[model samples]
Target: MTSLLPRTRTMFPGLTEWFDAAWPFGERNLVRIEEVAAEGEYVVRAELPGFDPEKDVHVAAENGMLTISAERQARKEEKGRSEFRYGSFSRTVALPRGAETAKIAATYHDGILEVKVPVAQTEATGQIEIPVKKD
Candidate 1:
């Protein structure tokens, strides 16, 4: 007699339904974000899996905010067998103080997207002093 323990979904319909409802079998989507501060720049690393560099990435900066968006094409094989499909994500972060927007750069490699922004330099102005006379 064969043990029907692992493949006993039919025996526990309620448990199978609960598990499926809690976490769909096919919809796998996740995004990991990391922020690093260096001496002269602030670096942000985003993990984007199964994404095309040409048509699925967008990076922009406006109003002191930097935005990164990425999308992945849906696989045809996952049409009916699984609930998971193509995923897309967008994240925006505020530019750090003294960060130079003009010198920002981004590169994607090995499923990791890295953005480097140069820190801005604030010039110190000379202080003015007023002389006080005793009345």
Candidate 2:
């Protein structure tokens, strides 16, 4: 997709890319994720800088919903002007259809979390017969 910013020099070029946000001198607490499907599976990659997996982050998958949450402690005190950072953050990404939720796996490494779910085999042996009469 071509960015509008390249075509026109609008006042707010970043408006089109608002999801790529920055706050408080480039410090952000929002969790960002990128997902891709390849090799009969979908892999989701998320970034949570300066967060501990053992104590700070929680990952869960249920009913085709994937949730990633984290809580970070306040680091340093701002004297004059401070952009208050959020302590806790949660990002829920809906899994694509046919995701094998029962075989999902997640791991965190170097501030990046990767979750993988294989695509379920979708096949129909025969059509179901529906009766007009109700039981």
Candidate 3:
């Protein structure tokens, strides 16, 4: 009944504090997303609960990169050991080679933000034709 990793906080207090300061929440500000390939299109789904899609979410595509960002403010009511995350979160991912940037669309439903990117499907024939020239 022991941990595999060493207890760094106890061994090196100052070092652990510095590491904590450098990354306050350690992946807390990163928006969790999943990329999927659908029929003739690419899809990206982001988990973003407790946020208004109209005002709190923003999506943009530029230079073959798609960016999804959201912001949620902390509540002002009294709290007793709450674990909800707040503040701004963003994630950027590369678009597929044939993704149509202009025709991209997004929708939010049931605490999930889904972005659909139209992409041209490419098929491989597994055989290549090479031309030979006489030396």
Candidate 4:
């Protein structure tokens, strides 16, 4: 089964983004993401604009976990007000119990990164075995 809980980290409960966007010097954490479980696949979408996916984005899977990381350099000589985020950012999520990490796929388009993880389907045998031992 897949976990429906979000694993994103933040300084404050719900104000980290606001504070970061306002101050632009706060300790940054995971990027915003949406996870969905389809009939035969688990999908995750992360919002990452103003970055070159081929050069700045990376995805990896290991030990039943999936991690997405990206880095962006700050623009120089900006006089006007700006609320853009810079530097490195990363987030990791646990893969579902039956997730097929070997066949994972990812794509970037329109400032969004989409990751697809194939899931293996297992049929229920409707039986359980219990072993007992003398103390």
Q: Write the per-residue lDDT of candidate 2 for residues 20-132, one digit (tens) a residue.
A: 44532463437888989885798988898778888998988888898889888876766665444458988888887888888988899999988898887667579889879
Which of candidates 2 and 4 reaches a greater TM-score?
A: 4
User: How big is the RMSD of model 2?
Assistant: 7.9
lDDT of each: 0.76, 0.77, 0.83, 0.83
- lDDT string for model 3 (1-135, tens) is 233445454675445434534255455434779999888899999999888999999999999999999998988867575546688889999999889999999999999999999998778669898999999
- The TM-scores of all predictions, comma-separated, are 0.64, 0.62, 0.69, 0.70
Question: 1 or 4: which has the higher TM-score?
Answer: 4
Instruction: Please list the Cα RMSD from the true structure of every candidate, rounded to 1 decimal place.
Output: 8.4, 7.9, 6.0, 9.3
After TM-score superposition, the amount by which residue 15's alpha carbon in candidate 2 deviates from its true location, in angstroms, is 13
Name the better of 2 and 4 by lDDT: 4
Candidate 4 colliding pairs? none
Taking the tens digit of each residue's C-alpha lDDT, what string does model 1 give over 1-135?
Answer: 223345464776455444543254543225567989888899999888667767898888888998888877666674466534366778888988888888999999998999999996677669878899999
**Residue 106, candidate 2: alpha-carbon lDDT:** 85
After superposition, which runs of candidate 1 have C-alpha atoms over 4 Å from their true positions?
1-29, 78-85, 123-135
* Error in Å for residue 133 of model 1: 7.1
> Which tens-of-lDDT digit does each residue in 9-114 have in candidate 4?
6434345445444245554455889999988899999999877999999999999999999998888875785556688999899998899998999999998999
Q: Per model, how many backbone clashes are there?
A: 2, 0, 0, 0
CA shift of 16, model 1, Å: 13
